[model samples]
Target: MSTKMIFINLPVEDLNRSKAFYEAVGWKVNADFTDENAACIVVDDNICLMLLTKTFFTTFSQRPIADTVAATAAAYALALASADEVDVLTDAAVAAGATEEHCPDKRAQEAEVGMHGRTFIDPDGHQWEPFYMAYQAA
Candidate 1:
């Protein structure tokens, strides 16, 4: 059998605050399973962000939780249909109080050729990148 990613669990200090941050950036919660300590932020039809309060998250693992606020060990990147979509999403993130880490810019040297991308940091400093590729005909 093949593996597929259905959910990503992120530990947060405040569940409500994390939910609000995601909501501001156009994500909705899965009400069927979300609660005061855990919220499922739907990213797409197959992707979801499981936001769990620190205390609740500890129940699942024994490893020390990474301090997201002060560390940059990982990031989430999303692809859009067009370069304009990247700008639009980045703008929405800014309006939602997310810090813009990198503005959208073209990278002709990469495999995407004329692609553009931007990065933003969520409230807890989780990095997210939105990108669009303009591929040349082979």
Candidate 2:
């Protein structure tokens, strides 16, 4: 089967707050699909996030929605074009009220090739790793 991209549903205790946080980081909402129960955050042409209220979110799953602030059940990572961009984005995250979980660090083996990364926690404590991997000559 051919693969196509879609949305990721994140259960949030406060839909408005989560929506605001993402908006501060430059995500746009798809009003056509948004309501009091959920907000469709557009990440890219094919990527999006369905930010659902906790009550509405539970309806779609048998398992309980994880408390992202209390425990890390999962993490989302994105790569940057350069190590400097990792630092730049991390700074922006902090300015947006995200907690800096770790300082930027270089991977020893990767250091020679200039790869580096850092981690941060969003308003709801979701972990995100923004990293940069340098190109290597084949």
Candidate 3:
């Protein structure tokens, strides 16, 4: 089977700020798909996120978009190469204006469960979780 690429689309209140936040998390924008109303954030070789302005995004859906600030329909989670990478990326996100979803102490408590992750809410109120876990072949 051929590999399928993933493209996650998110509506943003401010395109520039959204683009900056993604950049802070170490994602590069694919200029070929970027414009005033939208930006293509390259998450990895197989994953990409389309950050679209609410006005432009409305064209793709007939239903009213949820106000991210007031409600969230989904949480975008990403898996990283290592636990340290999760912290590094999450720290950068916080420095870039993202609010931490869990406190440092809570994260420590969660690590005891065998999975490690950091969650942050972006400027547009979209939730992003970066996590890491090691897998061993049986």
Candidate 4:
């Protein structure tokens, strides 16, 4: 089987600032897909995030961009290798200007079930949950 790719498109008020926030979270930018109005951040070989300026984004979508800060635009839940890794990434995000857990209940994952995670809101109000699970299904 071939590996499929997932590209998440996000609208940002400030392109440069958003790009810098993702980088501070330990991902690198794919310069080939980035320019003045948009940036492609390579989260991994299969995942990428395209941060587009609001003006540029409207060209692709007819609907009004949701006010992420006021409402839930999306939740990007990431599975990491271990609990420590989850903490590291979330910590870096917070240090890079991300708001740490607006919803305190979301800060911890299913710890009783051997999962641990931390939720954070990026500078642009996108929510990200980095987690680790002890069990894996076949």
Best by TM-score: 4
State the lDDT at 38 in candidate 3. Answer: 92
The RMSD (Cα, Å) of candidate 4 is 2.2
| Model 4 segments more than 4 A misplaced | 102-109, 136-138
Better of 1 and 2 by TM-score: 1
TM-score comparison, 2 vs 3, better candidate: 3
lDDT (Cα, tens digit) per residue for candidate 2, span 1-138: 436877888888788888887887777898999999999999767778899988999899899888889898787777778878788777877888799875434345556666677888988777877878766721
**Candidate with best lDDT:** 4
lDDT of every model, 2 decimals: 0.81, 0.80, 0.88, 0.89
Which of candidates 1 and 2 reaches a greater lDDT? 1
- Per-residue CA lDDT of model 1 for 1-138, tens digit only, reads 435767888888888888988887788899987988799999877789999999999988999888877887588888889878889888888888788884433334443466678888888778888887766621
RMSD of each: 3.1, 3.0, 2.6, 2.2
- TM-scores for all predictions: 0.84, 0.82, 0.89, 0.92
At residue 84, candidate 4 shows an lDDT of: 96
Q: If the candidates were sorted by their TM-score against the true structure, best first, what order would they fall in?
A: 4, 3, 1, 2
lDDT of 4 by residue, 1-138 (tens): 458999999999999999999999999999999999999999988999999999999999899999999988888999999889999999999999998875545434375567787889998899898988888521
Q: In model 4, where is the ten-residue run with the lowest total lDDT?
A: 102-111
